[model samples]
Target: MKKTLAVALALALTATACGSSDEQDDKSEFAENGTFVYAIPADPGELDPANAVLGATNTVLAFAYDTLVYSDADGKIVSGLAEKWEAQADKVTFTLRKGVTCADKSPVTPQTVADSMNYLSDPKNKAALLGVLIPAGMTATADEAAGTVTLATKDPNPFLLESMTAVYVVCGEGLKDRSILKDKTSGTGMYPLFTSVANDHYAFKARADYAWGPGGAKHEAGMPAAVQLKVVKDESTAANMMTTGELNGAQFTGADRKRVEAIPGVRKGSAPDGIGEFFFHQGDGRAAAENKVRGALVRALDLNELRAIASGGDPVPATRLISLAPDPCRGDSVTGNTPPADPGTAATLLDETGWKAGTDGVRTKGGEKLKLRVAYQTSAGPGVQAGMEYIAQKWKALGVETELVGSADAKYADSLFKDGDWDMAWVPLGLSLPTQLVGYLSGPGPDEQGSNFAHIRNPGYEQLTAEAAKKVGASGCEQWTNAEAALVENVDVVPVLRPTQLVASKNAMLEVIGGVVRPTSVRMLKN
Candidate 1:
């Protein structure tokens, strides 16, 4: 009787296993053997990971391209194509993993990696990270036989490894022809671009032979075969699509955040939001060039009230630019550096600066009314614009007249670089490390082809950053912190909210890995 009962139990277990397998197979028939869906707010027409500036484009490119180094969930540097690396005082060498191939099945030799480095190193190429991620004076050489790429640096780059994590490697074909990449990305990533429908969707086919994942991660068998990105601008529309079982995942921000979270099946995926604030123009000619007025501008707004509206939730006051996990030089740099918001003080400062309030309550100096043009970016959405309007109102209340302008992105860039018509503008600058801020800190003005948008030329801040650049790792954290302090103390930058990353998933189908979505993390789970 005991032996018969045991046999019955064994049969039951086998039947359960078979039933589970059948269920997965049935689901696979839906969309290209299970498609991982990503809902985007705006259409990132075509992904170009190498020069990605916006957060939306970077998310799409993350799956389509593989960087030289990987930062794990903890933001710890891990291996990618370069399986192993050695960093010395003057040089850093990486050993390219063997058998790695680009999306076109072309061998990713050491020479290919070296060629990518040489391409970006050229100033003419106008790579976004010209002086930021990629160090200024560096030459890359490859030994195909040894499967190694060597970078000999002219200056000591403390955050060299961290900066390298942002650079995605491309094969020679894509390197020579950038137009090919502009339409479709051909990279050493797991997914290759299959089709892109303008403003609709971007479909990708997974490479079964993919081997190189972050930290030597292997492509699991049950991973999604195809991933599709559906661009839905309206947050409510995206939430509706998720509830209707169309998309696997979506990111909802600002006012639409609560509505998306209310849906029963949606799961919230959170990551530390990037720090954002208005950086004052410090160029010699601008009205904001005066340190006192810049300080007054920051003080005029009611930040506590503004935070409630500007940010989706209770605003998390930003302490640093990159607050993501395992972030080097972690501390409260924003707290002490930022001055308390005082409207009364703002009025007094303007008065002290020879700009006295007239009968109309608008401050005036000499023959000119103290009027400032404030440009808010269109990409920040309606919520940020609403908040900026309130801040402008408060500025008006504080005696200074403000001309609020809703400038489109390209036009705003022109204002900073070409037109030079504005006194103040809102720009969201984000980076994973303090070292990356160096290029923006001390460089030629925007018109001069440098990232100094405000054309700030600060000798003291420049000196501090230059000294910080020489030391490696945590050794230079204090110097970097002090440099940021110099900017904040002088009111060059107004540190505001650290907006949280909001990723909403349908039926918990997809997950955010290492603060962003990746191909390896997507899987066909039982609903």
Candidate 2:
């Protein structure tokens, strides 16, 4: 049996289930070949898998790259580039499948895969997936004759194999010159980049000989000969395209969901993306740097109302940070862990902390005013924008001066990692394993080339997670749950709601694994 992790990011807000339509049961035949067109929210910057972070970039990369292993919708590890794999606490070995070739027609060798891993593990390379997928300081070795690549880490990782499912393998050519990947493909996926028009659209040509897909899936009858992704920023516009047959599939998470659900003959389904979390920056001089102020600010907002507003309806209240399916640790660490909604208590806490209300109704501590710059991703849809605005309104009522800053994915990343201008941010750090979150939650800040943007220093969380990492797989679930509870209890971060992402499709039958359209699972229907 193989261990799995739910680490897929929701790409372009859409994914299709195994059974995309009720009519598929009745109809056994479909079109032989056609183009499958879909919509993405923004331009996928830097096609190199190592540097790709934006969900849109991942969506495009999904069609052009393959991982060492494949994680199904059910969170099961299956064969991908590797025919088989063995994972232990400190190391993992992958056996390459025969006849695998890169988009450039070069045969994929074990050394090529090892070089990709080695590149990501090196800090000097500055790959975005450095610690997220390939652990920092990890090393890889390849045996050409045996056709195997083994990855070893000094620190033990129970979920090491699960994390490998997210690393996109780059071929030798792309590794030498990454600029080629910016506008093209250099991987061993079913589709290769054929044409790219930046923010407008991207087209990929299907490889007829490609056979190694998730769980041995292959190109079959009715599979799209080509795939095209159009940049459609507006949900209503994307939904309209889906209805008019301009788009084969699209995802809606906001008010446009109702419109997509009403379109007849469109196959629809839902998946758990991740929790919409509020992370307070603990950097010096920030208002939220004070623990009492953080608690008071959280208490001022009605979480129930905010969840409804953010999700566009009643959503499942997030129980833990891992909202994706098949969560190894099934426990509610968020409930009864956060501060309750009590404006009076919030005001009292602020008053006790020297944040007294002034003549302008804004709280002031010493001589400085209580001000916060709240940030969010504008591309997260209108619900998120409204949710940020709602927080600002609630904070204003609590006499805390607030400024809401919303930007696209690239700009948002720059704000959190480069500029460091935000006091609090409504960012969703989605991951399948608790161990994978250690760097983002505790390690060095962005200034030190680490992802701990919040700069959280919860000693209890670090201690608990360290103990949990020593154990293997599910045995450490209890400590992991307790660690998350400690973070919530300390008001270091707030888990709000887990939104059910809705996807709809027309004239196409396909399956989405790990929030990406499995290239071989797509089957075109006759118009």
Candidate 3:
């Protein structure tokens, strides 16, 4: 029987979902075109949800896996693998769907979902970013008879389901060997990893024996047949590939948007989030790494020029450590109206902090040159290099020496991050959950299995985040407000700008969901 109710709901949303566009010529490489080629900025660093936080990796892998719950375009949580859930008192019960299998042909179970969340919650795991999604003392349990799983938390976590999107469920068969994720990913998703050409491309084949998709899902068990994600890091190449029909969809910057749409058979749409920026390292023992200096650095940046160099003129300067999504962090309330970019102000701040300019105009304090070794991840691409160099020049004017390091290697970058070799760095921080920002502030940072990349620890800031996590969602307003205020008070990490991510798709493609906290099931219809 046709699910008329589900179809009607989808049709209702079509008004907002259907994007306006100028048609472009569509080309393809498949036999009668059963394959779709997608282009993104980077390759999937890892398929493991517990470790892999890159947008490209998650976006491509989402079709290959299923999570406990799903998030909508507006950052709201809805049901996914689970049919329905009941939250009673302090315990929550989740009813699982039937006949689900992993990509490797393993059965899905309540234990599987619970085990996956547990794995992500473990502190011993270095790459687990999902740990910050939940409260510190939450336990997950499985009930076989009811096909349900229960998560008991010490306190209320209204955004628990929203956080579950990051905890994508996997096969429970090999829970002991976590290394299976490094090579193979097992989940009850639409696509399975058929081939992965590292740094080049990856191929996913639709599961023939698949079932158990939610009612709102656009695609059923196996709709696309085969999904291909190509790594065309260059914007021009990706646009060219999309035009020639070698690729069906690609992520485009604001700069590429005009040119991409100018070609026939292509359309451009905006992703609902903000762009990434340079996260200044302001931890202990670093000379002149004070709040005044951090604020001064932000003032020195020509945000207009930065935005011009970036995809669009949309420069949402990160006034606070938190993201630009919520309106509470904007305007003169946090960052005073017109941030001062005066070199005199910056030099004066450094001078008062004991840093004196040498003969070379580079400041020094205690016989140590005030040159900061700003190391941006080599994998950040050429556009990032250009922006970093521009910022480097701006800092030089303030008598501060800046260094730009490039490499596509994450391991090498991880080594630098661990050893604290970077004075200031351009790192992509995944701040989906509100607490994730707090975790980056005072919790055991990424280097210590926490998100605190700045390695900043303040008791006051830590308390604010802790209090906020106790009540998420609408109720978390006070906690988040206080925490955000505390973070900005110190100016521990100066937020350069928030980015509105860019995604591109073929003319035949029906829809592309943007601003997703975690990659789930996104469908491209046969338009």
Which is the leading candidate under lDDT? 2
Name the candidate, 1 or 3, with the larger TM-score value. Answer: 1
Give one digit per residue, the lDDT tens place, for model 1 in 175-200: 66877877788788888778988788
| Residue 127 local lDDT, model 3 | 38
Model 2 lDDT, full chain set:
0.80
Of candidate 2, the 10-residue stretch with the lowest lDDT total is: 1-10
Model 3, range 1-527, lDDT digits (tens) per residue? 01111121111111121121213333432132257667766776767766655556666656677777665544455677887887543456788887767766777788888887676665566434534455556778999888999987776665565556555676754465777777566777777778888889888887666555433354442136677778877888887787787876765554566677676646555443433445557667775357667767766777567645542455655544433222222222145533456666777777778878899888888888877777764444455667788888898888888776664544434534455667776654434445545544565545555445567766776786667666545465566666656655565544455554445565334334322212223334443
Local error of candidate 2 at residue 463 (angstroms): 0.7
Stretches off by above 4 angstroms in model 1 are 1-33, 46-57, 123-132, 172-179, 323-327, 447-450, 508-516
lDDT of 3 at 13: 15
Q: Give the per-residue lDDT of model 2 (tens digit) for 1-527.
A: 00001122222234322223233463746787699998887788778888765667877998989988877766677888999998888898999999998888888999999998998889887777766667768999999999999999998987777777777999958977877876777898899889989889999999988988877878888889899999998888998898888999876777788889889888877666677889999987787888998999999999999998888784669898775423567679999999999999999999999999999999898899999999988867778888988999999999998889998866777788888999999877667667767777887888877778888989999999999998776778899999999999999989998877666778887665555566777788876
Candidates' C-alpha lDDT:
0.69, 0.80, 0.59
- Selected candidate, larger TM-score, 2 vs 3: 2
Alpha carbon deviation, residue 430, candidate 1 (Å): 2.1
TM-score of each: 0.85, 0.86, 0.75
